[model samples]
Target: MKASALWPMIIILTLIITACSNNDEASEEVDEEDLEETTEITAFMPEHDEMNFEENSFTKLMEDEYNIDFEFETTSWDGTAANERRQISLASGDYPDVYYLIPWVDQFSPSDLIRYGKQGVLLPLNDLIEEHAPNLQAVLDEDEEFRAMATAPDGNIYGVPQLVECFHCTWGNKMWLNTSWLDELDLETPETHEEFKETLMAFRDEDPNGNGEQDEIPLSGSTMTQKESIIPFLMNGFIYDDLETRLLIEDGKVDFAANKEEWRDGLEYIRSLYDEGLIDPGAFTQNADAYMQLGNEEPNILGAAPAVHIQLFTDNDNQYDFDALAPLEGPNAAYSSYTHPIEQGATFALTNKASSAAQIKSIQVLDYMFTEEGSLRAFFGEEGEGWKKPEEGDVAINEDVEPIYVDIPEGEDETLRNDNWAASAQYYHPVEFRDGIVQVEDIYTEEGFERRLQEATYLYEDQEPEDVFPYWGVWYGEDVQDEIAELETNILDNVDQSAVRFITGDLSLEDDWDDYIAGLESLGVERYVEINQDAYDKYLENVE
Candidate 1:
C-alpha cells in the first residue's frame, strides 16, 4: 500500500511540474508576439533616384528596431512639382500621417508651418519632442540659431528642421576663375577690384584658350539665383551685397545696401565692363542652362563664372581647370555673401492625421537620426555597403579632425543601390561630424570635390562683415509677414532690373540713379527695413 501510494503521489507531482513549465513557455511566446507588433505610419516624401524607401536598408532597420511599418507617398524631386503636390494634398485634406521632406528638394517654409500649425493640420511637436526626443532636445538646447529657426513665433515647434552644418555652403556666392587660362596667360589670381577688371580685359583681348577664335566670354553668370549672379561677387567689393535680402545692419540698425552711393559706384564699374564688352550681355538675361553652355563649350570659352561650385557651370571634364577667386577688395569693403548652414525650412513634420502611437514611433525614428551611429546609418546607409570606417592613412576633410567614415564609391554599372535615404534623412549633421568624413589626398579628383570646396571656402571665410544680419533665424509675425514678403519682392525686383538696365546702358547711371532710389522708396523700401528690423530684434530675443 505504501509503495503504490508513493508511486501515485510522485506521478501527480511530476504532472503538476510539467504543466507549470508548459504554462511558462506559453507566456513567453505571447510576450514575443507582443514585441513583434508594429505601428503603421504613412509618410509623404520626395522620390530620389538613389533610394527606394520600400527596399532601403535604413528603412528596413528602422522598421525592425522600432516595430514600425512605413508607407510612403512620394513625388519626383522636381522642386516645383513636388511643392505643388504637397500643397495639393494639404488643400484637398488628403495629406499623409507624416511629411518627411528633403530640404533642398522641398519642405514647409516658416510661413507654411505657422499657417498649418494654427490650422491644426500640422500637429504641435513641442510635447512629443520633449517627451520622446532627447537627442533632438539636446541639439535645440545647445544651438541657439537652430532653436530660433525651429520655433515659431507662438513658441511651438510644428516640425523638426534639418541641421546640416555644411561649411562650403555658407559662402554661396563665389567667383570660379579658369586657373588653367590664368596659368596659360601667366597672370596671377586677382586680389583687388582693379586687378579683377584687368584680368577680365586680358581674357577678352588675349587668346587664353588658344583656339584663336576671339570667342572667349571674359565673365559670365546666370539669372537663376543670387549665387549665379555676376553682380553680388563684384558688388560686394563696393557694398555688402547680401544678394537676396539687400539688407545691411550697421550699429544694430537695419538699412538697404542697394540704395547707398557705393552701390551706384559698383553699377558704374559694371557698366564700364559692359561697354568694353568684357561683361557678357547674356549674363544679365541667360538662365542656368544657357549660362552653363558658355562654360561647357569646346576648348572652354569661359574665363570666369559666378557659382557656388565649378560643377554647377561646367561638367567634370572642365571642373578641374577652374579655381575659386577670393573676394575682391574695393575702396569701401571686401565682403562675401554668407548664409548660415542651418537651412530655414522644417524637413520632418507630423500631421494631425497620424495616430498617437504612430506619432510617438515616428518621432522616435527621427530622434535616432540625431545620434552619430543612427545619423551615419540613416544618411550614408548600412556599414560596408554605403560607407565604412576610415582605414589607415585616410585623411579627413578637415585636417584637424580625426577621420570617422569613408564612403564606398558606387560601381560604374550600378545606377542606384536603393541603400540609403540620401538627403531626406539629414536631421542633424554638425560641423564635427561633417568634417570627420575621410577624403582622398588628391583634392582635384571627383571623389575629393568636397575637399576642394573646403579649401575654396577657407579663402572666403571671415570675409563677411562682422555685424552681418542673421537672416535664417528671423521669424516675422503673421501680421507683417505678407506685407514684408510683398515689399521684398517689389524692392528686390526693382533693384535687380534697374541695376541691369544701368549696366547695359538702357538707363544712364547719371540720369537714372535718382529714379532708381526713388523707385525703391515707392516700393516701400523703408517700410521693408522697418519690419525686418523689428523681426531681427525679436529674433535676438528668441535666440538669446
Candidate 2:
C-alpha cells in the first residue's frame, strides 16, 4: 500500500508543477506580445546613407517608449530628387502617414503646407499640438516668431517646423578676409568700402601669397547659394542687399532694394572692383567645389571669400588664416544681410492618410523631440555614447552660461554609426540649449569651430537695417502665392543677371540701369512688392 500510494502521489505532484510552469510560460508570452503591440505609422523621410533606421537606437527607444512603429518610405537625400519624390507621392495619392523631413535636404514650404492643408492632403496640426504636444505648444506660446511661422494666415497649424535657433545663421552673408594676407602686406583691417577696395588692390598687386605668378583670387565666392555670392557682402556697403530676396523693409513697408538708387551705386562700386580685376570673374559662375579649390590652393591664393562659414570654402589647415570682416562702411550705411535663425520650412507633417491613433502617436513622438532630453537623444543618440555631461573645466559656447553637455567625437573614417536620426529629428534646438553645450576654449581648434562662428557672427550682429524685411515668417494667400512665385522667379532672375552684366561691363549701369528697371517692372516688380507687403502685414498682425 505504501510503495504504490507514494508513486501515484509523486506523479500527481510532478504533473501539477509542470502545468503551473506551462501557465507561467503562456503568461510571459502574452505579456511580450502586448509589449510588442505598437501603432504603425508610415513616414516619408529623406534617406541619409550614414543612418540605418532599423538599427538606430533612437528609433528603438521611440518604438519602445511611445509604443509606435515607423514604416519608412525614404527618398534620396538629394534636394531635387527628394522634393520630386515627395510631390510624386502626393500627386499619386500614395503619400505616407507622416513626413519627417531634414531641413537642409528637403522639406515642405509654407505654400506646400497651405496647398496641402487646403486640399485635405495634410491634416491641420492645431488640434494635435493642442491635445498631444505640450513641449511644442510651450515653444509656440513662448516664441511669437515661431508661432507666426508655424501658423498659416487661415489660423491653422498645418505642420511642425524644425525650430533650430542657429545664431551664426542669422548673419549668413559674411566676408572672410585672409588676415594672413593682410599681415603679409602690412595692411590694416578695412573699415570702409574704399578701404576694402584698397585692401583688395593690395591683395591683387602686392603678391600677398609671395607667389611671383600673381595667382591670388583677391575676392571670390561661389554661385551655389546667395549666401556664397560676393555681391551681398560688397553691395551691403551701399544698400541693404539681402542677396536672395533683394527686398527691404522701410517703415514697415515692403520695398525692392534692386530698384533703389543706392542699389545702382552698389553695382557701380562692384563694377569698379570687376574693372580693376579685384573681383574674381569665376566667383559669379563657379560652384562650391571650384571656389573651395581656389581657397585650398597650395600657396593659399584666396585673399578673401564670402560665405556663411569659412569651413564651406577652406579646410581646417587654412581656416585659421582667415578672419571675419565686419560690414564695410559705405557712403550710405553699413549693413549685414540677416537671415532668420529659424529655418524656413516645416520638417514634420501628418498626412490625412494617418489613422487617428497614428496621428496621436506621431505628434507625441514629435513632441518628444521638442524636449531637451528627447531632443539630445533623437539628434545626438544616447548619453555617454553620443554625448556626455560636461566635465569640471568645460566651457560653454556662450561663456556666461554653464556647460551642460559635451559631444563624443566620432572617428574620421566612420561614416555610418546607425545610432541616431542625424538632422531629420532636429525639431527644437533653442539658443540656450545650443549655447549650453561645452566647447573648447581655443576658438582656433577644430573642436571650437562653432565658437569661432559665434565670435564671427558677433561682428555682423545688429548691422542689418533698422527695419529688415521679415521674409521667413510671412505667408502668402493661395490666390497670390502662385502669382508671387512666378513674378519672384522672373524678377529675381532678371535682377541677378542684370546685376552680373552691369558688374562685368556687359551692360553699362548708366544706360542699362533704367532698362533693367523697366524689365523688372514688366516682370511685375511693383506687384511683387505689393503682394509681399500684404503678406508682411499679415505676418506682423500674427506676431503682434
Clashes of each: 0, 0
422-469 per-residue lDDT for model 2 (tens digits):
788888888889888888878899989999998899999989888878
C-alpha TM-score for every candidate: 0.92, 0.92
lDDT of each: 0.86, 0.85
Off by more than 4 A, model 1: 1-36
Task: Give the range where candidate 2 is weakest over 10 consecutive residues by summed lDDT.
Answer: 21-30
- How much lDDT does candidate 1 score? 0.86
- Mind sharing the TM-score for model 1? 0.92
Global Cα RMSD, each model:
14.8, 14.5
lDDT per residue as tens, model 1, 410-521? 8899787676777888887898999988988787898898899989999999899988778888998889879988998899889999899999999998888888888899
lDDT of 1 at 354: 75
- Give the lowest summed-lDDT range of ten residues in model 1: 21-30
Error of 1 at 52 (Å): 2.8
Q: After aligning candidate 1 to the native by TM-score, how far in Å is the CA of 159 from where it should be?
A: 1.1
